[model samples]
Target: MLTNRQLQILQVIVDDFVTSAQPVGSRQISKKDWITFSPATIRNEMADLEELGFLEKTHTSSGRVPSEKGYRFYVDHLLQPQIIQADEANQIQSVFKQQMIEMEQLIRESANILSELTTYTTILLGPDVQQHKVKKFQIVPLTEQSAVAIIVTDNGHVENRLLTLPNGFSPSDIEKMVNILNDRLTGVPLQELHLKLEVEALEILKQHVKTADTVIQSLLNVSTGQKEGKIYYGGKTNMLNQPEFHDLNKIRMLMDLMDKESQLQSLFKPKDKGIQIRIGSENNHMAMENCSVITAPFSVGEEQYGAIAIIGPTRMDYKRVVTLLDMMRNGLSRALTKP
Candidate 1:
């Protein structure tokens, strides 16, 4: 455990490094407003910190910078949660009040606002549908052998799929199948629908004709396949301005990762509560080794919906980022619950 004075010096070093993007020296800390120690004493403490693996020296002459372990320790122990300033809170509330729209639009706008506020790339994943109940389904015939099926969930999410009818199946036959699907599938969660199909409907369809087996398989695939939730990304160019991404190779890898929606979705897998911080090397993606991700999950009613995340270099201001994300989550929750 570090002494109280040593902790103060470490905090000053981190704060200075974050602001200036430069390693902090003992002489600099001694001259700062908060320090009363002499330069030699501070240098001794910095050397001890380096030996303990909390700080690292990038060059022979340069001072110290916080390591990943240091950052994790600071966030978990030393950092205090900052309250959102009055003006910032009012601005966020104003945005939520002015643009009351559908859930999809709201989530997209929230991503835009968060990126603008934090000046870092932001990603918002639309709500997970595992718990969603199918409220309605509509089948529209596009051609004699093809039709469009639109499924609406209880949470205002709409999923559409195009299905090919069996050869020689009439439009009337398609309508009959649609009616049966709606009657049997409405108000049921998606996982249960697959079971119902295999147990009760598959035999009946098979008895109709041997071709019914293929039709049943196609229907089940359309219903239970990937949901393809919407992903909203903003502030792509903002990453270029960060110091850690000055390397072209790092920038290229990061851009590629950003383009992969599946990877971003995996990064923010749901947690219980509060914002989650993933630091360098802890992130599974090689491209994010120098980056940090702060994410918070938001919900609609009782269901955990989706997450909003801020992406920045590992030296990101956690206190400010955490406060901003907390406010964003609250605003999103309230907007979603609004009548």
Candidate 2:
């Protein structure tokens, strides 16, 4: 229930602090062309805002800084839309101009461009590649004792493994096994191949092939070796350049956390669509307490998808980042899904 004047003052403080990475003082607020208030009046309001827990004064300076609460309120209530400049928009569009580019390449370029624009580390979580159905599976025999197993997904991705053929496993046995697998698992997603093979497929294989257990074990080993939609990072080392991340211990902790690929996969799991902002302690990771993350989803058709995430110091320019991300998402969706 802030009065209009108080709200105006709060917005100004947030905007100034974000740009300068410095606290805002009454004199600076009074200097705004639209602000007719005297420095004394502005100072009084700043004090009251501090008392209300929206701002805090530094011990070394009388200037005020926005608390986490203040930043939350500013983004939620006072965010003014920022327009993307024409040149910047053109630059993003140009990344996809080359014909016959891939979704992975598009995501990789997006991460690099976003990181460069924001001067912060960026992460793009590619869609689960394992979700695609198995289009083909083949075993290319190299000799009587060994062969190469290849699994092709509907998306055109391929996985290949080599195994020693079981003793006395015949060429006829190989033909029958391949036939059984293709017939039963052609439409199954790569992630579920193991389970599909184990269920009814195993029994069918036992009845027809003498070395069914050995072959199944070899294929399951291949399935376990598969990795999907690995995390792609842009300017992964840029965090070291930020003033907030200058501490040696803090750098070590963040590096350690980012190295845990399994844990980071869940970071971009958003229940809702559109841009989401998580600031400082809101991220719940101790290493991220001084950072802010902005995330958004991009889709191919109405189905396949992935997420874009930008990480930077909490003082990052929210308006500009949000505008760029929205444009990137729209541009990528249009470009990657075409032919």
Candidate 3:
């Protein structure tokens, strides 16, 4: 446990290093408006804090920098939300309020805007449509031999496919099939639709629809698509602009990791519905040992969620990034899911 004064000094050191990416000296810390103590007194406290494993010196005779432990402590205890100005908030809001024809384009733009705003690498993890629960299903008849299968998830995400009805299947047969699917599978997850169709819904289809097995197979194929999800990235080159990433080897590590979308998918681990912060080595990935990962999750509807991940040097402006992601997730949920 830290005393009030010690916590204050640590907070100042963290905030200063996060901005400047430099070792903090007592003289430098003393210049802050809140530090009324003399440089000598603050130096004594710094030594004590170092002994307690919170700070480390980069060189034998250099000033102090926060160790991974120190950063973890600072993130867990000393961080606060840095409120963005109204003008800045409005600028971000403007992007979402504009109705774009495609959610994918809106997400792409959002990633770019966040990276520009924070000067950090940002990733938007799009929810897997394969996992979204069914909200409604429609069978639009184009002709006696053809129709379209439209499935809407509870989150408002939609997937559709052109389906050809087998010969001898009538309009009445199509209605019966749609009713049976909606009755048995309205709340079923997309990933499980195939099994549900085969086990229960298909049995009902076999009884009422002619060439029932064939038509049922077509509906199942359309309902359970194989569309793989993607990760939207902003500022893939932005981290090169950060001082902490000056090492070419470190830059290569990040580049390689980002190149693998499957690895990027495994990088995010949100504990609950709240924002998650992983400082330096805490992320448990070697490539991320010198980086910090911050995430905020938002829901579109039942079991459908996506997140904003900001990747930066360990000396990240935690206060600002956290607040920005919080605003972004909420705004995105509203924009995409609202009627």
Candidate 4:
């Protein structure tokens, strides 16, 4: 619904604000070499854009800043696909070059690199472990009172938990409990392991093991822990450097949100398989009203696995972040799915 000239002016305002964190005046837009309009004509366009809700005039300055709607429109309509520079592409490639690296290490390294490149907070949600079925279960006794409960998933990820053996719980009871877990839980997805254990395995354990309740509780703790993808963070404190985050109250809310797993999980949940951008209030959380989040889902082959997200002020460098995220998403998918 916008004229070409109006769109051109809006893009300029967004680009300038993103770089300088200041309201952009018509004089500034007119100074661009590509802009053919005079300052008066550009100011008319700016006024029109503001009336259309794409720009907001600040109380302290005559210059204009892009509203949240402006940023959305710019990203959806005016943003151009940016080609990753060779050196930056090489930097991303370096994350995958190591041989025999653990999955956690790869994801952790990717998060760090993305944060370093963007200079923003980066979050990587690891592959969903619930989709992986149980591959093996073992309980190794450490002493008469304690043992290590190990759960190995089909993806080769291992989880270990220390369980305190119940008083008078015998070696025979331990052996029986391990047998029941392997029999009823092998090949079961981690998400369903807890319910399956309670419904089908608990009765079997009770018939054979004297301390079935205690044993089931310990196993449930381990299975429940693996129900969600692990979260990895890089540059968690980078947001403190952004000018918008200088407010103490805002910083406190954001920091609290980061420490909470459920909140962080919700932030990364993807609406679709492609890149998703939530600017300001679109996030529906007050703590994020001044922030923008960009998410890119990564997959292994055709199965969507997990996602990566970057959080920054609403004046984010959308073109650069989007391009880098897509490149990294493709690279992560290839690295994960490679045979």
Candidate 5:
């Protein structure tokens, strides 16, 4: 538990360091308009804060820098809601107001806008199509041995897979399979379609189709193998401008991590329904130890569709970024789900 004075001093130190990227000295803190403490008294509190591991005294200077512990505490306790400027609020509103048709384009543009607004790297994960229910299913025949199976989701996304027909498969087999799938699987979420088929649709298909085994196997593959959400990035190179990334080895590692889709996906933990902040070391990646990640999940209707993440130095402007994400997520959800 920190005294009121300690909390006040900590907030000022964090705010100042975030702006200037410099270690803060007691004398520098005493000069703030709101601080009434003399330099000596403030320095005593600084030393105590350092002893408590909330602050670190750099070897090169007597001034103090907030430790990861300090940052975590500050974020959890001291942050107040920051109102964005009217022009900036208008800019965000304009994104949703645009007559955009495709959700992907809207998400991509949002990523760019956020990165520009925060001057940090932005990552937007597109809606997970697996959560979408089946609106329709279509089978189009091509050659005697091959055909295409199309799955249309309730949200109007279409996924097509080419399948090799089993020997002796006939048009009646195709028609029966399509009818059985449409009858049984319509309105089933894609992620649940596989289990629903194995448990429910298989028995129905067996009763109707001659080549039930092969046909059911192909459908199973389709449900289980659909791609996960696509990732969109904005200001991929923006981290290069942060002073902490000047180390060549750090920059190389960070750039490499960004190139990997699998690793990048790991940054957004599951069930992150609200704004979550992970500071340095909490991020659990070597490349991100000097970084901070702020994530907010966006949704389509009631289901969690995807997430947005902003990556910046640990000395991030938390108040501003959090405000932007809070507004942006609501706007995105509304636009995507609007009738």
Candidate 6:
């Protein structure tokens, strides 16, 4: 319900604070060539904005800063979609062109490029393995009692784990087990393989009882317990350079959250293809209350796959971040699809 003048004043305050990282005063607003209002009138509008929870005054100063709510409103209402310049697009395209051979390399390079471009920590979630069908599985004997199980997914991703065999199990027996397992369940998704193994285990115990029980348990444990979707992070130290993270405790909390990739991934669970912006305090994590997250989901096909996000202080350059992220997502999708 803010008047047009009030909204204009609020936009100026937000834009100035985002650029300079300083609180905006009515005097500064009045001095702007674009603002036609007098200092008294602008100050009254700012006061009304503060009362409406869109602005906050720091200390005893007359200067005002946009609250998290104000930022949310501005992004949802006042902001327009920004266009990426040709030079920026060229730089990103060059990076993609250089690393188009491998998916992991492409994602890693994208994360690095994004962090460098934005000067903020960037996280790229690798593609989900559960949705990928198993291309191949092999059991290689390492020692008399140990074997390495390697599973390759349809998307060219590989996972390996060592399995300890029963004391008397021979290498030949392990090979036999591998052949049997692969023959029965090679092309299925790893998640489905786990379920199929559970059902087969009961039948195998009732029928083949002694021979398949031990092998079934070993294969089930290795395949089903495999972890997937690693998180790649870059420019973690960049957070410390922001004014909001000058506090040691704040930096520590952010560092800890970054270190916990599982938690960070959970924080940005996929929610469709569009960009999502989480302002300060909207995030459930208490440590991230002063920060903002800008994320966009990407996919290999019809199914939504993974996401990339930029983390910065709440006063971050939203227009630029949104523009860059949207472009990055499209670039990443194109890079991933390239042969």
How high is the CA lDDT of each candidate model? 0.79, 0.83, 0.83, 0.88, 0.87, 0.79
lDDT of 2 by residue, 1-339 (tens): 888999999999999988887889999999999999999999999999999889989887889999888888888898876998798888888897976555567788889988888788888887777776787889888898888888876654567778679889888988898999899999897788889988968899999997878778788864574364668898998899888788999888888878887777777555567899998899889888888888888875457777888888887788888888888888877775664
Highest lDDT scorer: 4
Backbone clashes, each candidate: 0, 0, 0, 0, 0, 0
Off by over 4 Å in 3: 133-229
lDDT tens digits, residues 122-212, model 1?
A: 8888775655677777777788777777777666656677777678876666566666667777788765667867787677656545455
Model 5 TM-score, all chains together: 0.77
Q: What is the overall TM-score of model 4 with all chains considered together?
A: 0.81
Candidate 6 lDDT by residue in tens digits, 205-266? 43533455555566676445536576888797999999989999999988888888779878
lDDT of 3: 0.83
Screening candidate 3 with a backbone cut-off below 3 angstroms (N, C-alpha, C), the clashing residue pairs are none
RMSD over all Cα atoms, model 4: 4.1
Identify the candidate with maximal TM-score. Answer: 4
Q: Alpha carbon lDDT of residue 233, candidate 2?
A: 90
TM-score versus the correct structure, for each prediction: 0.76, 0.79, 0.77, 0.81, 0.77, 0.78
* Positional deviation of residue 139's Cα in model 1 after best superposition, in angstroms: 11
Q: Check candidate 2 and list the clashing pairs.
A: none
Estimate candidate 6's alpha-carbon lDDT, on a 0 to 1 scale. Answer: 0.79
* Candidate 1 segments exceeding 4 Å error: 134-152, 158-228
RMSD of model 6, in Å? Answer: 4.8
Model 1 weakest 10-residue run by lDDT: 205-214
In candidate 2, stretches whose alpha carbon ends up further than 4 angstroms from where it belongs are 135-186, 192-222, 225-228, 336-339
